[model samples]
Target: MTGATTLFTGRITRRSMSGLIIAVLLVTPLEAFAYDNPIVTGTVPLRAGLLLLILLGLRTTRITAVEAGQLFLAQALLSMATWSVLLDFDPNRIAVQTLAYGTILPVCTLLIAPKATRRRWAFLVFCVTLYPAVVRLTPENLGLLAQVIATLLVHGASVAALDTHADRAELAGEMADIDPLTGLLNRRAALNELARGVDRSADDQRSAAIVLLDLDHFKQLNDTLGHEAGDDTLRHVAHVLAAFVRPTDHVCRWGGEEFLVVLPDADEALAIDMAERLRLRLVDVGVTASFGVAEVEAADTVTSWVRRADDAMYVAKHEGRNTVHVARRTDRLTVERPGALGAP
Candidate 1:
């Protein structure tokens, strides 16, 4: 299977595991209650183990923030409803149920929810499960308020700790796919996007273009104006490219002094126009770049398409900077340099 199919299958597996674990946790207590088997204290440990497994499985799967939030909410409601029915309105069991619902459910949800939405989801779970329990406490049972308070404190601290972990994981993922200097997609992410674009173009019978850009005299600027200024110039160029491109386009920092723009559904003429527009925009910022444009072809692979653009870019560099070159798929060896007919 392809990488995408594998990823999709893995995600489905993780989600299935999560659902199974949730079902087991929810049903196990009810089963013990139904059978009146007090020896089944293994519920906690079993649930804890399953929750850990689900968390571990999530490390490789991608779940959206909204989905995570919804999962937490569902877990909270299921736990509350299950405990309420299993305890059969016993006042003595209220404290135990409160502790379990407040602590276990929030911990599980926080572990699964996205870091950015963890706190909100935690608070939501708490209010949904614990607040009602606290409100239902009679005046004669006021002493149980202390247990509720302690559980709240523990849940709060757990959410904070889990949120910290989520933030760190998110930051690591971001750093992996992001170029620090220009804030554009890094090489690995760009290649992934290229593969996706190739698939999309092939499946839809539409053309896509790759524009390879190299800033002219970037090395001289770095030498004379210091690396900081060169960094700023790179960022400015990135901004210009981003501003000029459509939302369907992707911009990536291919490497030092070079950037790649992937334009979906664009033909050779359209790609040349985009490159020229980008070149003119950079000129407004007192910088110039060479652009190599190539359209996708029926038999073209990612490497061949990018190499075509790279070859055209070299032609632009040779002819003179601040120009655009077109490399068509029909002519692999011919580099349509700037000033050539139909060149930008």
Candidate 2:
């Protein structure tokens, strides 16, 4: 779900940027005629065309938010430099241009970095300071001091507001990925992580594994102990699983009483050992779970890999619950050990 939201946000941002580029292209011809400036009449159209091409590249590519923000900032700076050089830094023209971009550029900076850090603040200060210095360097341009100062204040305020907004957006995205009951990642987020792990394992030629577990006779426990007890049991199990996994591992509630753990850079042996330990831990806490371990294969898709693990888990249940089983490469599961709670 978080991935989908990010993709949607990226599409919206790209479309908005494309629209801005098209608007700029349409306005350039008018500017050339209205101003009758040889540079605008001759060179601006070519620059606009180049910008349009860059916008098209943006449409065809996948880039991070920071990268896109940096690209936009680079183009803005290039445009400013072009105006400064071609028009001989005419104070009136440069001042007007600088003020026009003051807000837009700072907002772009927010895209590059939304965190409130000293380095980021320093960069913004440099940008805000540059235009005023240029305007004030020419004695006659001193008359625009009030306008420059106002622009600086406005830019400062906007940065604070924009950074706060970005923080909230990031927090919301994170919250959307979490399970309200277990405080673990939900199924969608888990599947995304598993897909990434599979791709990484395939690309790097490294091993990865997954452990799928389901509470044994959870329906009987809920029926006997009530729904509140079931909720507490789920939360307790989630906490135990989360605490046992390594920092690099991803633990997720795959729904109901089932949990999935993605172990990147781990082989079959390590996965089985981890599963045994986890099962023992649950038993120590007066609960039992069935665990299935499956190592990622060379040609394995996320779906196939998870299905193997799920198949192994059901095999454990069929053999008697609270057992551990390992899925063979050929899609068969062999029971490793009888569960502590077997046949009860």
Candidate 3:
């Protein structure tokens, strides 16, 4: 199968798994309570079914884990009310319900709650579960409360550890894709983004361009002002490039003294305008860069597109540094200098 087809299939499978988990969680309580009392078998399923429908409808709101925990507590309370009103509260039945809730509710909370709110939800569950026992204060009820507290602590700790590990892994992935010197996207990340841009431009039939920038006389600057000055210059240029571009655009440090900007849905004119603006922006920071712009073509690969921009940038350098040069469809060059109305 094609990669796109495989990706679609994988998404469907994941969504199916999520739905199955919810279905199991909804039905498990009904099954557990059914065996305890015959009337519960009839009433619990109806209540759980209605609750599931409500939750399903509210799924679009992106409910948080803490809210999910609270909902579960509400369900438990409703069950208790049913037992008390219809059948008269039996101590043995209440104990059984509490034991079931202590085990299941914490596990559900751990699965859904965000890391920031996980402990809070756990504490809320503990307090809610102990409310019934607190009212009576008998020895056996106190023992039940203790069991619930222990269950929550053990499960909460496990969830917190898992969340910490996941966060570390995510941070490591981000660090790998970032340029340590300039704090811009590194070369690998830039290339990956370009590939995605290419696909999107093709599918949508929209224009896109890549700009290649090289700081003019960078080595001379480094020798005259020291490497520390060179580093500061690069950081300043990176900041200017990032700030000037739209959020939809991407700026990356493509190795020493070089940067690449990917502009989606932009034509050659728009690309040249952006490049010139960037060249002007850096003058305030005591550096100048040569820019080359190339619009996407039907025959272009990622390598070819970048190569075209690179060739145009060299043309800008040859025309006396600190200018914008655009690579035309016919492979000819159009050079734009400061204060010029049209490229010559």
**Each candidate's lDDT (Cα)?**
0.71, 0.74, 0.69
lDDT accuracy of residue 33 in candidate 2: 74
Query: What tens-digit string does per-residue lDDT give for candidate 1 at 1-344?
Result: 01011111111234554664566667666756653634334444454454544555454435533344345456546646655655445555667667767776665556555545656766777767776566667576677867676767876886688668767886788689988888888899899888977886777677888899998888778888999998898888887787778866888999999999988778888889989988888888899888889988877788988888888887778777789989865544454443352322
Writing each residue's lDDT as its tens digit, candidate 2 over 1-344 gives 21111211321365566666676668767766755777767777777777666676766545533455456567666766666566664566566666656656665555444344533743563475355446444577665756675776777677777667767987898798899998899998898888987887887677899999999888888889999999999999998998888867888999999999889889999999999999999999999999889999988999999989988887878777788999997766454433533532
lDDT of 2 at 178: 95
Superposed Cα deviation of residue 188, candidate 2 (Å):
1.2
Question: Measured by TM-score, how close is model 3 to the native structure?
Answer: 0.56
- lDDT (10s digit) by residue, model 3, range 54-153: 4554453344333444465567657655654466444555555555565555545544455556557655665565456445435646676566557656
Report clash pairs, candidate 1: none
Off by over 4 Å in 3: 1-158, 204-207, 332-344
Query: What is candidate 1's TM-score against the reference?
Result: 0.56
Q: Native-vs-model 3 lDDT?
A: 0.69
Per-residue lDDT value at 209 in model 1: 87
Order the candidates by lDDT, highest first — what do you get? 2, 1, 3
